[model samples]
Target: MSILAIKHGIWKVAGEEVRQVKQVTLDSEFELEEIIQSNPAILQDNWLIIGRQVMTVYNTYIDLLAIDNNGSIIIIELKKHKTNREVVAQGLDYASWVKTLSPSQISTIYDDYVSRYYENQNTLEEEYYEKFRIQLEEESINNSHQIVIVASEMDSSTERIVEYLSDSLIPINVIFFTVFEENSTKFISRAWMIDPQETLENATNSVRDKEPWNGEYYVSFGDENNRSWIDALKYGFISGGGGEWYSRTLNQLSVGDRVWVNIPKVGYVGVGTVADTAKKADEVFFNDIDGEKKSIYKLSKNAKYHEEYLEDGINAEYIVKVNWLKAMTENNAASEIGFFGNQNTVCKPRASKWVHTVNRLKEIWQIK
Candidate 1:
């Protein structure tokens, strides 16, 4: 509390002498965006992408052109003093222009940029061309996309850009970073990249703000008592496996026939008919499953389908509608086939149980 005590406290805190190694400079404190700006390898050393500044396009040359490891162009807009919300529009503009370029045009752009820098950058063109050839063969290069925003602080430039992008329904990210000051110590620095949207969403609003969940919640009013989801489930299952041999082929059922196969380990496999005939390929798709691709298949006999499913009192009440809400509660039922799985390892709730469960939810919600 005294002056002498305060001075002693200050001295104690600064007791150590500044070391010579403290003067060494390093870029370790830069965020991902800034890192890429200096050394593109912050991503990886893939030639499919190269960092460059465009001479003829938007007055702004990009901080990084993070192309796909193959050829899909990933336009990166980096901000050192700003945030992504600042440059999304400009980045989008560049993306639009880049998308319009043909393979030849793209090569020319690369060549043009190259010619200015490399004496014989024509060689880079061939290498890129060969890489593109491989990418096409591998079924890559769907489209060039992806927005990146990086900065230690989101300034007015960043906020303006983010608001505009959000209003335009442009899916872009605002990567916030905490830039640290250099300390008189050995080579060590720290920085961070955080999602700005998440931070904003978590912040309290002064007036009427929207729900934090956004649209991720159920679109259709979730009526815990509604039996409609049950009906939807029953209709989902197309029954009638033709025979036993069908289960072996994973399609022992003929087209147009709905068959359920019982896997002792994984439960029943169901497939609905999309075609008709012995050779007709099974649509083999699932009705409703999440986190997987579920498909139904044609079968020979409904017995084979039921053989595995029917046990004890399960089929006693016809199970016209099951308490799917209950089943889901008992089990992790966030998937399309939250109730069950079809072939292709996809989830397809059993027709009877699925429908019944849906209705049960309606029942609980008392909607229908």
Candidate 2:
């Protein structure tokens, strides 16, 4: 809670010799809002700012409106240092209005926000996929929402109300941002009242009413600048690369695990059983069209998997061999409303939508 520093390798904590940083007050709540608007990542990553001073049907305006990768609307309200319980009540008021918004209305709100702020930006759907690396399903948009009350600090009453609401399965929270001045330089740090990931999980589960995971994994086959989905279909494998975060999830697959692969912005293209655990790109060999065994690096010139980081342990591509039960080209990929999606390369989706997606895919692919 306190930012302290040592000068000349000598610690000072007593009397006039103590070195302390001055915590300063922000010029205005608008100044805090400007900092957040310019960089939404300061609040959270994978969020797209949809509106500023967003108006409600009740003739009130929300401080900032955003949408996360999961398509849940994020209502960010701002206040100066030490906010009161009224802000909590106000946040609930705004959420009540946000909960009833239809998909078209959400799109229109984004359009207005763009027209007023960003002159050179894509439409809602285009920007959503670009930011999240997954297509936006209209039916899933705004199915749930979160309220974030940000201030320099929260008073006891406000914190208590937020905790109660969050504990009751309401996706609401408070964030504290403190500004400090040290030797003519200003720095800002942030903290949350509750663990964000815990809040998100509780919110998602409560709103989605997801069923138990059925032991199947969801794979996002991001066949873009680095890898090729065509090569994957031909080679009997799935992959991820460019960074550890991208490739590490493939390690979750083991021999005999079932996986359903979805190509980002495309559709569900394959369902298969894992034939092997993950291996590095150059280490994975497949029999080519010539019936000659060759490394993936050699067989698929177009993919050039992790060419930039072939030998780099952290960034190199990783592959998991699969035996397809049924697979299709991108042109024949199956897509429909309400299918489960995630940015992770592999996840055990427990949402009801995932169950529906698998059942429908079984019928479409005639896979029994």
Candidate 3:
């Protein structure tokens, strides 16, 4: 319904306007390590790692033992000052040992921890946090022990160990974060995500085929039944919550707002809020970006994404602004760029003519 109502994909209505967004947060030379250290997203309770000195022999006692928010224990082997390649091998050894813990054994470890681990030991004990951890782990892993590694870096020898262990076809993940100083700024940051599969997919898709607008861009919305299709789109495009989750929140939402929903099957959906009804229609107009004189051209009733009449040149009056507008930066990867602006919708190019019209045609996406 909305696809046909506002501007088409790439084009929008001219006289319609938006308030000029104040460039309030001027970009500054800040330390990335500090920024990473302060990132709220990474410090989630569900994925926090906890443990102490888990041993895998071979002159390697794990530096720390901790469960990720996911309830799997991470065998952390830290290297101070400079590290050797064998540290990675040690991590793999710990990973193997962690994979052998039984349900009862894992719970026992957590039981011994709750009262001794934190500042408010009573709080966790009272809440039966150990029981909760056990329950969560039970629900998460099926039969095998969940294992992972946490280190600042991987040496070639350890990298080789990881390769060997991984080649055995086990469901294990490796996480490495580095603490470094750049431009007089110290940063404690994860080198990147544990998975490289998605990054490779993104690179293949985003080459030369960039978004038309300099704003934000999103991927296609997904349905429960059509998971793989949705996943592929997300991997292939800069998509977030651009579908049902966004549409459902319209009653409580406005233009220029953003939301993130991590679908278990599809990863993350970054939806920018737009119009919800006839009341919002008046508010969803485009203010002139340039202060030049403007003219309005009424378009014919061809219900396409951008406009079917690019054959007629820039003849259309205005374009529709949807969940588009990606940042113009070096690499253009979402994880590799600076973020600013309303999570609200963007009018960006979709098809060839830059139609911002997203082809999200799920019935759940329709507003009442």
lDDT of 2 by residue, 200-264 (tens): 64456545476787888889888876788898898889998766657777877799999999986
- Give per-residue CA lDDT, model 3, range 1-49, as digits (tens): 0101111112223487633322111132133222322342342223333
**Alpha-carbon error at 38 in model 3, in Å?**
11
Candidate 3: which stretches are off by over 4 Å?
Answer: 1-46, 55-60, 68-71, 80-83, 122-176, 180-185, 193-368
Error of 3 at 65 (Å): 3.3
Off by over 4 Å in 2: 1-23, 81-85, 115-140, 154-169, 192-209, 231-258, 264-266, 272-300, 304-348, 360-368
> What TM-score does model 2 achieve against the real structure?
0.67
lDDT of 3: 0.34
Per-model RMSD to reference: 19.4, 6.7, 19.3
Q: Give the TM-scores of the predictions, in the order they appear.
A: 0.35, 0.67, 0.36
Residue 266 of model 3 has an lDDT of 33
The C-alpha stretches of model 1 lying farther than 4 A from their native spots are: 1-38, 43-48, 56-60, 80-86, 113-142, 155-169, 176-368
Assess each prediction's global lDDT (C-alpha) against the native: 0.36, 0.81, 0.34
Candidate order, TM-score descending: 2, 3, 1
Instruction: Arrange candidates, best lDDT first.
Output: 2, 1, 3
Number of the top-ranking candidate, with TM-score as the measure: 2
lDDT (10s digit) by residue, model 1, range 1-368: 00111011011133576423223333543445445545543432332444456543656676556444334555666564443444656666776666565555555556665566456564444655564322232222313344555444455665655555544334344544332223543332222232322221222110122222211101111112211222223334222222221122222224343322222123222222323322212333434434454322222211223333334222111111111221222122233333322221111232343444344434543533
